[model samples]
Target: MFFLQMSGFPGSGKSTLAREIAKFTKAVIIDHDIVKTGLLEGLELEGQDKNIDPKRAGGVAYHIEWSLVDFYLSQGHSVILDSPCLYDVIVENGTTLAEKHSAKYKYVECVLNDIYELNNRLKNRERMITQIGPVDIPEERWQEVINRAKKPTHLECLKVDTSQHVDDYIGDVLLYIDK
Candidate 1:
């Protein structure tokens, strides 16, 4: 099975690209923010100590995501996950999920041109609230999370710059998947 996880900062166009990829490839897309936000609903970072930790939110995202990965892989479907998966825990979890299912996995990192565009998108974006919850991460927390986002190396991953034309970037992803 093909498992694709889109990684990038919030409002970096990962979700939009994931939708495009899913449409073209007919793959199942599992959005991380959607899950994270759902898990975040009614739950404010309440305190600056425990609740504000990005890792804490990531830990929650990891379990939910891996579970879905397992479920979809068992059904023999390719999975496309869209989220700001910039933490080692997320990458490690993705690797673990792939190993457990013996499925081929790919990581797609979305690169935005600038913070201005990203902020604009985030401010106007409408996210889906699934089983997780509604996410209302404050500006400070958003920066904190971005600063903590892990940058992937030339391991078993593919990076796509979303600032480019969609067709061009997506073509690269399709080519990578073909290989």
Candidate 2:
């Protein structure tokens, strides 16, 4: 089994690249936004307050995401974890999960070199509503997220510039997977 973890800021095309990789690898995608949305729905179903705290929901979603990764890996299936993964703890936990399953772990970091383009992408409310559902942060907050992201130093990661079409890098990603 192989475990692929994606790290990138919002609107950096992490999910897009994950899907492209999944098409070639046939890996199951554990998208953080989808999981967090589900957790929020579960909270609503449980009669919790209508305005559920994003942080609390995100914590539960991450827990569930890791559990799902473990479960799928245990079943000998490759998994693509699609998330920002800005924190070291998240990367460490993913590494641990991969080791526990005796699977090859790979990390992919997507980046947009042009800040203006990234901000423009983030400002697309329709796209955000379709993908992440109204969780778009203001343009000013994007820098904070980028500043807080701890780049993975301990592991060899593939750095992808997602400012252009991601298909150009699919072959490279496939080669990495073969490694």
Q: Report the Cα lDDT for candidate 2.
A: 0.81
Model 2 C-alpha lDDT per residue in residues 1-179, reported as the tens digit of each score: 78998988777888889999999889999999888877777777999997877877778889999999999999999999999887787888889999999998898888875667776777764452124432345667665655565555777888888887987988998788768
Q: Pick the candidate with the highest TM-score.
A: 2
Report the C-alpha lDDT of model 1 over 4-63, residue by residue, as the tens digit. Answer: 777877667787888888887888888766676666663655433435455576578768
Candidate 1 accuracy as lDDT: 0.70
**Model-by-model lDDT, in order?**
0.70, 0.81
TM-score of each: 0.74, 0.86
Alpha carbon lDDT of residue 159, candidate 1? 67
